[model samples]
Target: MDQDRGYNNYYSSRNSRQYEESSNWRRGNVNWDSQWPTDRYSNSDYYGYTRSDTPFNNYNQSSARYEEDYSRNSYELDPRTMEFDRLVELLHPKFMSEYLNKILTFLKSNNTEICFPHIAPYKEAFLVRIASDHKNLECPAFDETCQNISRSIRDFLYKNSKLFVWSHSYESGKITKNTADTASSPNVILKSSSSDAIDKDSKHKQSRLKKKQIELVSTDFKIQAMKTILDFIKDDSRSLLQYPDLSEVQANFLYTLLSCYDKPEDGAEKSLLLTPLVEALKIYSLKYQFRINKDTNDEDCRFITLEKTLKGKSSENNFNDSLKSPSPSIMDYQDLDDWNTDVENSDATDHRSDGVPDFGGKLNKNQRKLRYLFDQVTTDFKMTVLQKSLDYIEDNSRSSVQFLNLTIHESRFLKCLNSFPLSKKSYFLIEKQCVPLIMKLRRVLEP
Candidate 1:
C-alpha cells in the first residue's frame, strides 16, 4: 500500500508540469524565435514563422516606417521658410556690422540651432562661441554652424572697419580754413557808366553771355587755385615727400587747367598767348633744376661755361680787329695797275731777237732777263709772303666765333629740319656763327 502511494504521487507531479506547459503554449505571449525560448516554443508545432510570438520584430518595422514618413513629410517647407531664407540673404558675413543689430534681433526670436545652420554655415562653432561669450550670451555650442557665422561676422567687421577708418583718414586730410576770414574779405563792386544801355536781347543770347562769363570766372579761379597749390609746394617747410598724394592732386589740377586751354583749331594761337604760363613753367623748372638730360655729376654745366667763355673772347677779338683794319682805297688799285704796266713795257723793249737767239745772246738776254727776273722774284716773293701772313692772322681772329655760331645754328637746324641729312658745309657754317650767340644770350638770361 505505501509503494503504490509513492508511484501515484510521482505520476501526479509529472502530469501537473505537462498541464502548465500546454497552458503557456496556448496563451502565445512569449516569442518562440527569441534566443531565450519559453514554454510556448517547447510545445509549438511551427518551427520558424509565428506572427503572435514576434512582437520585437513588429515593433522594429513600425519604428522604421514612422521614421521614413517623418523624414519625407517634414521635408516640404512652406513660404515662411523661403521668406526666412530671403531675410538671411540680406546679411553679408563680411560686412556684418551694418546688419549686426538686425541679425541679433532675428537670432533672439529664432532658434539659433535652426538658423545657425544657414547663417555662418562655414565657420567653426568655437569662434561663434567667442562672440557669444563677449556678449555674455549662451554660447552656440561648438559646431559647424556657430563657427561659420562667427568667422563671417568677424571678417565682415574687420573689412568694413578698415574702410571706415580709411575714409575718415582721407576726410581729415582735406584743407580746412576759417569761414569768418572768408566772409570778412572785401567784395568788389562793378562800376558801369549811366549812359551804357543794357541790351534786353533774346533769352538765348543772355544765357550764352552768362555762360561765357561763368566760364571765364571759373578759368580765372582755377588759375588762382593752381598758383596757390604751387606756392604750397614751394614752401620749404612743407614735406611733400610725406604727402605724395598732394603732389598727385596738384598734377591732376594742373592737367585739367591745361586741358581747358587746349582747343583743336586754336591750339597754336593759344600756346602763343600762354606766355605767362610758359614763364611760370620756366620758373618752376629752374627752382627744381629739372632737365630731360639730368647731369648729376655737374659736368654739363662746367663744359657749357667753358664753351661760353672761349666763344665770347673770340667774338670780341674778331669785332675789334674788324674795326682796326684800314679800308682799301680805289687809288691803291690804280697804283697797282700802273706798276704792272710799266714792268711789262720794260721787258718787251729789252727783248730784241729776230730769230731764236744764240746761247751767248740768249745768255746776254737771259742776264737782262735774270736781272729783271731776280728783282721781280724778290718783290713778288716778299709781297706774297706778307699777304699770306695777313691772311693767317685774319683767319685766326674769325675762326673761334665762326665755330661757335656753326654749332648753335646746326642744333637749331636739327630741331627744325624735317627732311633728309643736312649738307656738311651748311652745317659747319651754322655751327661756326649761331652757337656762340645762343650761349651768350642764355648766360645773360640765367639768374
Candidate 2:
C-alpha cells in the first residue's frame, strides 16, 4: 500500500511540472534568457530568415531608387539653378538665417565687400540685422559682413538679371533698349574688328540710347499725367464735357496708355485702379470714339478723335453735337448705290442730278431681281393655296346636296383671303421689300 502511494505522488509531481511549463508558454512568459540561445534573442538576429526576407531589403531597395532618381535629376537641379531660386526667394521682404548664410557664403567665396548704394533702397539696415543674427557677432565685423553679403547679392543679381524676370535697373533698361534697337535695325552691320566702323557704331548706339532714355522719361511722365486725367474723369460723370475738343493725339495717347494697363497679368493694384477708369471711359461713350486719318490709314492711327466741340455751344447740352456736323465727302454711305447706277447709265444719254433715282434703275439690280423672283414665288404660293381651298370646297359641294351652303362657304373664304394683310399684290409690297431691307440692315449691323 505504501509503494502504490509513492508512485501516485511521483506521477502527480511530473504532471504538475509539465502543466506549469505549458501555462508559462501560453502566458508568453517563457524565460528565453534561460531556454534559448543568447544569439537568438540578440537584436542583430534575423530569426530563421535570411537578410533578403527582412524589412532591410525593402529599405535598401527604396534607398537605391532614391539614389537613381537623384542621379537622373542632378543635371537640372545644379548649383546655378539652386542659386537662381535663392535669388528669386530673396526678392520678398523677409528672409531667414538659412538664406543669409547662403548669401554670406557666396559673398565670402567671391571675396567681395558690400557697398551702400549698390543694394536696394531701405534694405541695408535690415540686412545688417540679418547678418548679426546669423553670426551672433558684434560691432564693425557684423556690419562689414552684412555689407559684403548685400553687395555680392546685388552684383550677382545685376550680372544675371536677364535670367530672371523682375524689373531691371534704369541703366539696364538702356542696355535692353540698345540691344533691341540694334536687333531691329538689320541695316547697321557689325564689323568685328574695324576701328572706324566700331567708332561709328558706338556713336550711333550712344545717340540712339540717349533718344530712348529721353523717350522713356517722357513716357513715364505721360503715364503719370494720364493717371491724373483718368482720376479727373472718374470724379465727375459729365467731366468729359471739360474736354469737348480732345485732339487726335491726346485721344490716342490716352487709349494707348489704357491698353497697356489693361493686360490680363496686371498686378492687383494696377487692375484695381484701371477697372474704374475703363468703366468711366466706356460710360462716357469714348469706347468706340476714334478719328480716321486718311494719310496713314493704319488701324492704330495717331490722330484719334474721341470728341469734338461746337463754336459758342455748351459741352453739357451738346454731348453728341458732333453727330449734327456735316458728314465728310469721303464718308458717303449713299455713294455706292449712286456709283453703281451711274455705271449702269454710263452708256445711256440722259442723266439727271437727283443722285440715284428711286425708280427702276435706282435700286440695286440684284436686290430688285431677288425681290421680283420672291414676289412671283409668293404669288404662285398664294394662288396654290386659293386653288386648294376651292378644290376642298368643290369636293364638299359635290358630296352635299345643299348648294346654298357651299356658295356661302366659298364667298366667306374669298372675303377672308381679301381681308388678309399679305394676300393681295398691293398689301404684299412690305413683304416684297422686307427681305432686301433685312439684307441691307444685316450688312450695316455687322461688327
Candidate 3:
C-alpha cells in the first residue's frame, strides 16, 4: 500500500512539473539564459527574450536591446549641437545647412543697412535694425542678393501687366495706345516702346468717324435724288395727276440721280448742280399758289382778267375764245313769248329797245360755247394736267399728305360744282377746269 502511495505521489509531482512548463511556454516566459546560443545572445542580447539569432523578435525586445547598446557607447554632445543634428536629420543636410548659412551671412552683413523705404515697416524694420547694428559686416554682398530678388519681382509684375493689356484689348474689341491712355491714368504708362501700339486708338476713332460720314452722305444723296425727280415731273405739264402711273423708267432715273449724288469720289462740280434743281422745285411750289382758285365763279372773272392781263405777253393769243360777251339785264325779259323768242333767236345778233341791243342773244351763244369748252377742259385736259402734277408731287415731294391737303384751295370749287344750278354741260365745265387747277396747285405747293 505504501508503494502504491509513492507511485501516486511521483506521478502527481511529474504532472504538476509538466503543467508549469506548459504554462511558462504559453506565457512567452522562455528561459533565454539557458536556451539561447551563447555566442549569439552574449552581452548584446536584446532585453531578455531577443538575441541576434532571431530575426523575428517583437518590437519591445529590439527597442530594449538598442537602448542598452546606446547607453553603453553613445558620446555626450552640446544641447545645441544635438538639436542641430536632429534638425539636419529632419530636414536634409544639404538644404538646411545652405539656408542657415545664408541667413547668418545676411544678418551679419546687413547689420547697419536699411533694406526698404521708411513706410514698409514689416519688411524694413528687421533689415534696418540688422544693418544699423552691424558695422563690421560686408553689406555689398547682401545688397547684391536683394537687388537680384527685386529685379525678379519687377520682371514678374511687368509680364503680368502685359498679359492684362492684351486680355483687356481683346475683350474691348481692340486695344490701342490711346485706349490704354484713356483706361489708365497719365502716371500709368504701359512699358511699351512700339509706335504702332500707340497709334491703334487713333485709327479706331478715325474708322468710326468715317463710317458716320458715309451714312450722312447716303442720306443727303437720297434727299437730293428725290428732289430731282420731283422737278422733272413738275416741268412736264402733260402728266396725269389724279392717278399717275409710276413707271420703272422714272424709278430708275430717280435711283440714278441718287447713285450719282452718293458717289463718294464724285467732284464738287457734279454735286453743285443739284442745288439749283432743288431751288427750282422750291420756286415752283411757291409760285403755284398764286395762279389758281377753286370756285368757278371766282375764277371765271379772274380767268377773263388773267387772259386780258396776259394779252400780248405771249406770242400766241389764245384769249379770244375765252372772252365774256355783254348780256341783257333780267328786266329786259318782257313776257314768256318774248323770252321764248329771245331764247330761239339767241343765235341772232340784235339791239334791245334800251339800246343794250339784242346783244344778249349773241352773248348767250358765246357763253354756251365757253361752257362747252370748260367741260372738255375739266374732264380731259385739266384732268391730265392735274394727274401729271400729282404724279410729280408723289414722286418728289418731301412734304406730308396732310400738309398738302390743308394748303390746296380746291374744296370751294368742289362745293360750287355740287351747288351749281346749271345744265350738265355747264356743271361739267366748271368741275373740270376750276377744281383740277386748284388741286394741281395744292399738290405742287404742299406735296
Best by lDDT: 2
Best-first order by TM-score: 2, 1, 3
> Regarding TM-score, does 1 or 2 come out ahead?
2
For candidate 1, the per-residue lDDT at 282 reads 42
Write candidate 3's Cα lDDT for 123-242 as tens digits: 222222222233212223334444344344334435545432221211111112223221131111222224355456545655454334333444454465446455443653321111
**Per-residue lDDT for 195 in model 1?**
11
Off by over 4 Å in 3: 1-274, 279-418, 421-447
Task: Give Cα-based local distance difference scores for all models.
Answer: 0.30, 0.35, 0.32
TM-score of 3: 0.15
Q: Rank the candidates by lDDT, best first.
A: 2, 3, 1
TM-score of every model?
0.15, 0.19, 0.15
Instruction: Please report how far candidate 3 places residue 317 from its true position, in Å.
Output: 12
- What's the CA error at residue 381 for candidate 3, in Å? 12
TM-score of structure candidate 2: 0.19
Instruction: Please report the candidate that would top TM-score against the real structure.
Output: 2
Q: By lDDT, is 1 or 2 better?
A: 2
Q: Select the stronger candidate by TM-score from 1 and 3.
A: 1
